[model samples]
Target: MKRIYNTLFIVGFISLFMSSCNDWLDVRPSDEIKEEYLFETGNGYRTALNGIYRKLATFDLYGSNLSWGLIDGWGLVYNLDKAPDDGGGRAMKKIATFSFKHSELTPTTDAMWDAAWNIIANCNNLAQQVENEDTLLFYDRTHERDMIFAEAIALRAYMHFDLLRIYAPSLLMNPGERTFIPYVDKYPSYLSDRQTVSYCLQHIIDDLKKAQSILLSVDKSASFSMESRFIQSYNGESRFLGYRGYRMNYYAVTAELARVYLYAQKADEAYAEAKKVIDVVESKKWFAASTSSSGFNKGNMKMMEDIIFSLYSTDLTDWDQKINHLSDNPADEYNEHYLCLGDELVNEFFGSEKSSDWRLIYQLEGKYYDYYYRTLKYNKQKEGTTYSKVNDEMIPMIRMSEVYYIAAEAIYKTDPALAQKYLSSVKKGRGIKNVDYSQVTSEEEFINMIVSDARREFVGEGQTFFMYKRLKKNLLGMEGYSWKEVEAKEENMVLPLPDSESNI
Candidate 1:
């Protein structure tokens, strides 16, 4: 089932708390905090930041829609072209036909698109306020302003990069020829058709570069010290409100930059950026996933070691009540939607030992069909309290592990040998003991292999469709039997601007 956009009211309520007293829904920040003020100080800035994080966790955006619902549920169920017309089902169904109009998608999908830009709007608003900051609360406005500005730019860059991936063509195939959805840098002014895929890619790169510049300006000591002082001084409730999770931290911003560069095919540059985090990225403890939750709870966003960028919430139990019921059974709490891999692709990957592969094994009775093995990485728990839920499971927008894969693939186009080194790093970690070094004979083969691994590893995590689009691979049957015949078109490359935004 597709996730509905019914919870937009909650988002609006959150927005109300984040806004200035003069204008609750408005994007602009004000100088003073009134009942309506959204950005009067560092705390208000934090609230605005929390607002963006909230959007990331919302049902319409990453929380359910972009993550499990759209990517896993819709894509998988529609593998044979069987898309439900439920509240969130349209995009997945329409994608295969290359027939989704701007008007056809659910408000949920529309809100995700809008929410990303809305984040950009917030970042812009904050960036302007921080640049001209005059709030009496800060002892040193310049230093604080610089850090906040960097985070804002990084957040904007992150949001824009995400928008481009879903709404643009592959960067490798005539990137200069394809159009992307509207690239809103300043506040969105008018609805525009797609730009050349290259244009969109370039736009992302430029924004990221700006983010890197602003982010680089921040003093590392100051990063930890500012929040530390706030925590030390404030009481519990005050501290909780003060530390509301928002704003791109240093690692999150850098991790996303590595990913953007990798997609742009700047392998060496991507590696250089990723290398900066090698220590942080490679630490086994950091990358180790938490396993405390059950069923759908398993996929809940918890603070894992390697989560460079993710959304968070203190209300997971409530979230569980709302989205958890959709899971078929207690132990079978994985994504209902997925890219139904055609028999051929599954056969190719599984070989004769298909049943031995963990991903191909069916654990639950009802989850599998004759040809399919439902993914278990996101399994929900079988038992829990009425309000039982998991934390540390947020929508993973970026992660350090992605840096490994992106670095591997990006380098394939440049240094094939070096690319293999990076590929082995991940493959070895996944327990694929001693992969044949000779298997990656050429760039194409290497890319194909790595991407295939990516699909399997990141299954139900919302990375596949963008990847297929980025590689310009034939949509049909790229991975499996039923999908072997799909071909995405120009219109398919970039979804039309949503009518809601266009009409506005």
Candidate 2:
């Protein structure tokens, strides 16, 4: 496993420099060029940064397991029993059933741990080089240099937070409890000690603050807003320096800070951060809610209009092929493998008088599995082609809708009317009529409404599990197999650290 880890790291890092010649740092390397040469120029830093994103688009990380395949399946949003009894299906069953100790899960768990840390390792390497005086000398534009560093810091924090989300107990459950997962900033040595969850979260928050500060400094506009500069910087010729929604820009960092605060249960702070993002994004017209019926349809790479941050990957077809189990021929249904949506999800989201919700339109009737619904969310096939021809597939990582949810939840205790307004914005965007706050009887009911909306809004995006874990709520689907049942048998809310770390 260690050997595999090292091999993956080396390949990923090398590919960072070799993969792209345009937009990315485009220097050709000499036969004897050392690793140090790669960071001696601004282009080198840019290439290195792009490399991190490329690695993120691979099968192990956001491209698959972290998004629709493993994590969302674990959320019990899908009918895991319908999955074939292959290695992938067995792993999904272990995750869904909360059978954390099954030996079959070792490979999946180990891959997640290694891939996250591997990205962190690359982050540390980039930070170390970028901070050097010699590297600073190569910066033709200091703003570009600062922007690169800011993104690196933010990306590092994001990866650490995700690692904690996967490997440590939820803050709501364990508060300041120590976890086996170490908050690694520097490249890891075997001697690293585990940090408390509180310590890790604080570290993540601090890094995001640094990123926010750096981004603000780069903005020379009268408003001194990084978001404004990010918009202005996107002239066609200067695309390299322009901050796209796909990149970790100022608003993305702010959105992430709100998420971290919500996880920490800092309601006031979370509300403030979320509201700040909402105001800036709306005022600037950075994104709009998707009201089109074909918003999530196949062949469309951009899923919505209100995406705050996403990953542009040519490898989206790989993800598409993995989940495209539906066929034109009914005969293929028995042999094909797919993740089926749970009846609970279908009924809760689509079984309402407000059936006009655009999200509901993506559900296709399953010919193979009776009474099952298969999602076209991952289906990227074109009109005539068997698969998507689109290379630049945008996989949404964050969006404006999440901010509204966070704001609504954070302020629900003090300002029910305001919270309901925030929640109503999401519903209004989805074509549902304005929600009457008077109809909501209690705080718990309002919270459930927000959770339910989130379940529908982010069905295949791999956010539902994190929502369940954070709120410590029971899974609404699967009779007798809710999170409450799993919580009873589990010592902690998270999967155990892999043997590699446990042995250490």
Candidate 3:
């Protein structure tokens, strides 16, 4: 068994950077090498897990497209003022318009697909190693092996969930057999075929539940927060025990479960998971709501305290400067991906509390940028000194406010009053002196309010699109278009699968 495990780990590690699982299986390195050193110690096991996270934060993933670049364009988060053929210099126009099949979009579509699976492949490697790992190998920390194992499971499920959302149709309304994305699990997952929509949802839910059971206990003793998850340097074995916020800590796994359940349209399960996080957040004080305007500042624009789970990308500082662009000059490098908004859209979108909505007043204010509502959510280079390294290079994956949104959306139809209270919590946290849920009287209105808040809260974080996609909400007016709203359809909603996938 030991010899067999060693061979598998060695082969898997060799293909860690390969673009696809199929490529991963085919790698025939000129010289055989062993990664037995990595699994021999508790921290060695940790090294494998942390490597998965580093890959997740790359420019191809959350550090760029998944957060504020390509994904946001699909969410219609930016104003694509230039026409592609007009040769006006901005390529964001084509992406924002969602030219999925366009030749130029192929590299991105392919990269995203490859990047996701590559990271998933890493998860598979760490997962298999940790599951059969000897408890004694984890040294003095009790249940540490389970912690690593559970995070890998949750991360794998989280990746599959996104793949389903991005590559398939929104089955909440248009339930059909036509849409599917693979639910990859095993190492050398080359044979994992695309599954039905419902099939994928069940597996995602099951994986999260499995992770939840292990992490619930693992995280209680660990209780990782944004601050707790770090040290002066990540140089020691003890470093693995900290940084719960960076990993799929208990709350993060729960939050992710809530997100998955909601996507699965299992509102009751979603509500329970989401509400559980909201209830414990204040008591545990692991993660919290931003009670003041400090979070909206340029330095803390990703709102460090409110984050549930995030990626600490080493490349973040430099990466955001180009994408969260502030240049009035068109020729600025990577300016085509620049994200911005008009002043009127900001006010109209947030409703009556627009005056106190810190997102508008502080996060989108012009003091730091060349244009109105230009976001500093990702870019902090100009104000880097003010931002603490504790939260620097961090790209948010989930936040406290999203838990509330999930809870409210999950229960809105069954219990409107309580659902409104959930919305009011996020509103109050956002600097609204008077939280109001009066307008959310009807289900349609309540759903719209949630979508509206998504636009306001998830400006460049690349969340609003999934929210819009899940609910199939029309793109709320803006984007320099006064015409009727664009209806959500498979063509516009589903990101075209790369040829590797569609061809297969």
The superposed Cα distance between candidate 1 and the true structure at residue 6, in angstroms, equals: 23
| Per-structure clash totals for the candidates | 42, 0, 1
True-vs-predicted CA distance for residue 150, candidate 3, Å? 0.8
The TM-score of candidate 2 is 0.85
Q: What is the TM-score (0 to 1) of candidate 1?
A: 0.73
lDDT of 3 by residue, 1-504 (tens): 111111232222223332221223343342222345557777567667766777777777787778877777677675544112221113345566667777776777677777787767767788888898778888646589888888888888988888888888777657577646677787755455667889988988888899999988887676455456543345465566766777788888899989888887788999999988887876776567667775444356666777888887656766555454435455553234445665456666777877778777766645224334566665554444455565567888998888899999888878888888888887877787676666556788887787777788887687887887788777653565342256787777887777666643
lDDT of 3: 0.69
Query: Residue 79 in model 1: shift from native, Å?
Result: 4.1
Candidate with more favorable, higher lDDT: 1 or 2: 2
Q: Which pairs clash (backbone N, Cα, C closer than 3 Å) in model 3? A: 229-243
**What lDDT tens digits, residue by residue, belong to model 1 across residues 1-504?**
001111111123244333322343434433224323545556666555555567667666676566655655423322433223543555555554555564565555666775666666666666666667764544345555666666767777777777777665556655576455655555323344456656766777776667667655653533232123112355643442232123466655666778777678777777888776665444423443233223223332222334555564444333433332344454553444333444455666545435433334432122345454433333333444321233234445665557777777766666777777776666544434456657667778887777666655565467766676667765534433333444544455555556554432
Candidate 1's error at 25, in angstroms? 9.3
lDDT of 2 by residue, 1-504 (tens): 232222212223234432211233335343212346666656667667777787776667888778776787677777765665552567777787777778877788788777787787777767766764353554446677777778888998999898888777677675456555666666434355678888898999999999988877664342323243223445543555554665787777888999989998888988988987778656865555655545344444334456677776666655565555433346666555566665555676555623566566544454354455666665655554312343136567887788889999999999988898888878776767746566678888998889888887776677888888888886655532232234421253477877667843
Model 1, C-alpha of 364: deviation from truth (Å):
9.4
Model 2 sits at a Cα RMSD from the real structure of: 5.1
Runs off by more than 4 Å, candidate 3: 1-37, 82-92, 224-226, 230-235, 295-298, 326-337, 367-371, 381-387, 481-484
